[model samples]
Target chain A: MSLFIVNILDGLVTGLLLFMLCSGLTLIFSMMGVLNFAHASFYMLGAYFGYQISTYVGFWPGLILAPIIVGFIGAAVERYGLRRVHKFGHVPELIFTFGLALLIEEVVQYFWGKSQMAFEAPGVLKFAAFSIAGNAFPAYKVFMIFIAMGVFLVLLYILTKTRIGMIIQAALSYPETVQNLGHNVPMIFMGVFGVGTAMAAIAGVIAGPVLGTFPGMAVLLGSIVFVTIVIGGLGSLWGALVASLLIGWLQTFAAAYNLRMADLLVAIGLTEPVDVAQSMLSDLWTLTLPQVGPILPYLLMIIVLVIRPNGLLGKRET
Target chain B: MNRFTKSLLGAAFAGAAMVGSFSIAHAEGTIKIAFIDPLSGPFASTGNQGLSHYKFAAEELVNSKGGVLDGQKFEIVAFDNKISAKESLIQLKVAIDQGIRFIAQGNSSGVANAITDAVKKHNRRNPDQQVIFLNYSAVDPALTNDKCNFWHFRFDANADIKMDALTDVMAANEDIKKVYLIGQDYSFGKAVAAAAVKFLKAKRPDVEIVGNELHPIGKVKDFTPYARKIIASGADAMITGNWGSDMVGLGKAVIEAGFDNPIYTYYAASDGITKTFGEAGEGKLKLVMEGQLNPPVSDRAAAYTAKFEKQYPDYDIGQPRIANVIEMLAKAINKAGTATDMAKVAYALEGMEHDSIWGTKVVMRASDHQAIQDVHILAHTAKDVTFDFDNSGYGLRAESTVKMASADSATTCKMKRP
Candidate 1:
């Protein structure tokens, strides 16, 4: 019973982190129809910026300030940089983002060098929240969960309640009609792009200490974030949330349990140990969900692309 | 031509001829030592350190006095393998094409494995242009065991050697009966953990193995849960083969969870780990390795360390293995009187005794080319806590005790001298 609770909590924490990156990515993709390959690079930039600022201003202010700076940078980039490249078609736009990722990483290296910079959690969040059956859950994790939940709620409210929300929803269905009704579609895209980057930056601030602040971090998270967006349905916010939660839970449960294929084989009365180490079966038996967590979203993406095409909760053809 | 004008033209021609000769000599000259390692990605820090140390040794120590091989200056041409095996092999081919004879470094085990065959083949093809590989860090036991080669010289002890030494230390402490094993799920990790188990069981049959866990490399964020499992296993000591970020991060997590049991690790804990563990790590961890960090070091070593710190403030000279390797390489080149001749340098290195920055005379065993040195088992003392080495006469409390393994009995590698 305690184990089950532990797994669920683990799933929730992991899920929230995935949602943070995926939510921004999906929103941007919906508005722009261009996958920002450099989305994770923005996250890495946030972490580096947060590390620098927090050194002077402390963690709380850095967390709040870093995202705003990253968002502004995102807006500027979309306005001047990505906007010019977008005219070259989707493939070129994709190439531009890829190049941007490489450039950001180089810039990061130029400033921060190759070593990992230490970014500690705030003093208040350093302690454990409580122990469950002799295992202590960290206070910082609880804080992270609360922060993620707050972001999700605020984003949901802004998207569903405001005039901007209606415009975005309308634009998603018929961009031509929305533009025809006197809305500047390009400005909307730039705004969505800014907000998306800000979300990624916020995720970076929270994750810096755990994932580490390094130049390679962008590359590590870049493909995984793409997988997250694809699995969530390219442009569906709700689908992203659901998919993130599902993946988070799946990985957590897999790691928590010590289930092996040998155990399964025994259960089914195939008691003879059939050269388990001789084949890929050993890799399967040893495969914990967390071990395969980075690939899970990609596998789901392939399945969705083949089966649903529009993605779960994604809008069907008009 | 007139006499005065003819003289001027002759001088100009002579100067031009001399300039041409100098450029040709330089282009044809440099005896290239090819350094291959991952120069990008997460593991790049290790590669950078290796490059810096090699550069330092080559410049300040080797070439400064009078150069090597009858005053022929040494040159190092580096290639970034990026920690990929396939890439390293390609890089090796490129290095070979560039007329590289002397090779060094196996920065990561996988890269080392990939380039080993190339090193062997090149040496066989061009006997006069022999390639000698000096392994700075890759401690995979299989490299010396099943994959042992004549051309390869491991500067550090193989994984099994270190693990065996660790096991010997554990055997004396009978109080450490129940052992929990955790390591990165890879070949090096597996070898170290397996060696630990094998040696411990053979030496002390009463010692029980409580639990064995393998964590995926580069994936684990939180190791607190892993720590909890170790505590639940009721183990007296926890053994691990994790290093670098994995080591530091996991060590911090374990320390935060207040794991009081003695942690026996196969590699040296970095200053990074000590910083993460903060005040908690003091006297709690025991890392068995080839050298010590604080004190009992000679005045010369102390001065060298002070100088090193002044030069490179960002990095720590506390890593004895790195310092020792640099010292040995320098001494070998000086003794051999040539950097290019593999036979002379290899001979000078084999059974060579020299003083290291750690303030100990380490003898390189001729048989296996392993350093026969004292494994200085240093304890983590708080930065604030000062031990009076000379004034108080209290000496250093080794937390547990330092166990020195004699280099004589460890190996019996039969080699034919060239």
Candidate 2:
């Protein structure tokens, strides 16, 4: 069905956007063994910065420059701020990131105030890509999918093909050995942290118009980022990709169809068919794919955590 | 020597006595009013706006003009609610512990329900200490319908009232044979959608119900699939109870799909969506608001906005709902002639007939404490800017069309004023 195809595409695009944030979080979690709660806050910063820069110099350049600025800030935080907190143990590192997340939101409010910023789509990407089953898929959505895929590929290439990539992987599994092997391990950690944050920033630039640049975006995206990383496995990039796509597709399909629970119950012989109007749970049980989209990723994460523990494709790190 | 010592002691005692008397004179007793809302978390934007409006009303405006009540100065005591129902229970206790009697604002219905229960329990235990809860927003119809409280006074129309009014507008346009109903999945959204369906079915029996979709709130980052559903449903028009990102994203997705069908939405449209779609949204979307920024605004509304713009250069004064509530509350206090007695204030508010910036007089129904006001319908228009290379500019112009709905017709509360 055309509806089926459209939902798949919608899911793919949504999944890819989730991947952008999850990928960065997974990389940082693998390398540092500390969950950076502020990762989504960095993404929010990207959106606000992109909005400000685009307002002055147009959206395209802001798209490019905002990530770099965010990258430097991430790197600086890892080097000076996070490094000091890291010595206090993993809990303190998490607490620092949490504090950073709260601070970033407050700072954003102080600057932009508590209101939604109207970030419009650029002229070039305004039109629909094409129509399927009487529905037009916008050019911006295609642009977003390509941008996310590009980021994923670039990250994959850097992690696998390059000498620095091998060094980073070695540092992640056996940091003590890697440091003993005479490589600048701390510098590498900081670089990876910066690179991860930059990816989230890139997502923010592209997503700002669609999501609306607001003070609450960071808090909204924060848990989802954690969910994606957890479901994928904290240190596994491939696991994250798999989980993101799965979640995206699952939610899209959920919101697209309207399947009432009463129908299911009657078919399964659990309950007799009665007037749906009489049931208090009828309205609640009318499960549509769209209604379940946002919570699907968390549900998947909890399921994965209970079952696999180490994630679908993740290797257990000491 | 004894006389000199006595005179020095007497001078010190007189100075101390003068300082004590001055402190007592300045105090005059402070009345603490709690401003309860989501001060932190995702809904903080709405919550913060509510807080700001209350502060401006209490401290900068009302209190500055010799306070709301004679012999008592109104003091606003606010706290970060975190926007949770369970958290509101704790916050209510904290507010009570701080000696706050009159609660001014509650943003969400879920949180308000918890606070109301807490207030009721406190009242039952100590019959003399009953707190008055004034709600500004939270448009769940059940608040006035099944869950009407004697202590709670809702200022805004419930979801049912607004939806009924919306249905009335659509009933006149016989050409609109089919409509797609979309709303955020919450109490407010469900109530609005239910009211729309009920009224539309009863009034327009010939009209077909095409698609009614309830999407998850805050989680819908991409609404392309939903737009596809609307298009496929072949609806004549769309009525949405979406606000914030859901509204913005859904509008953009719908616009991009070339879905030229009219969109009739419940929420205000001064931000996000109009800003996102720009000129593309012109003539396509019809947003209903309480007041308009365009000329023909009442002298009071114009002067208030002008003064507000001068005071806060960054803020958009087009959002007059919160400010209007503040003015109405102030007027209620003035009419009652006593700020300390909430029963008197409530009585004044019930029968209160006042003119607002909308250039129309609103009457507060004494039955349910709901305000009957005019809904300003506007169409988005493209601005002709020669400096722009493309059609990148848009402005919300007030359309010539006006539709009026009486406040009494929508309310289900069968209350007789005491």
Off by over 4 Å in 2: A81-99, A169-182, A229-234, A277-285, A298-310, A316-318, B1-103, B110-135, B142-155, B270-280, B317-352, B380-404, B407-418
Model 1 lDDT per residue over A222-265, tens place: 77677766666788888888888887776656555545655666
Query: In candidate 1, how many Å is residue B303 off?
Result: 0.8
Residue range with the least summed lDDT across 10 consecutive positions in model 2 chain B: B383-392
- Considering summed lDDT, which 10 consecutive residues are worst modelled in model 1 chain A? A285-294
Best candidate, lDDT-wise?
2
Model 1 TM-score, 2 decimals: 0.84
DockQ of candidate 1, scored on C-alphas against the true complex (2 decimals): 0.25
Candidate 1 local Cα displacement, residue A99, angstroms: 2.9
lDDT of 2 by residue, B181-246 (tens): 988888777776787889899889888889887888877766777787888887889988888777
Q: Estimate each model's TM-score.
A: 0.84, 0.80
Alpha-carbon RMSD, each predicted model: 8.9, 9.5
Best-fitting candidate, scored by DockQ: 2
Worst 10 residues of 1 chain B by lDDT: B388-397
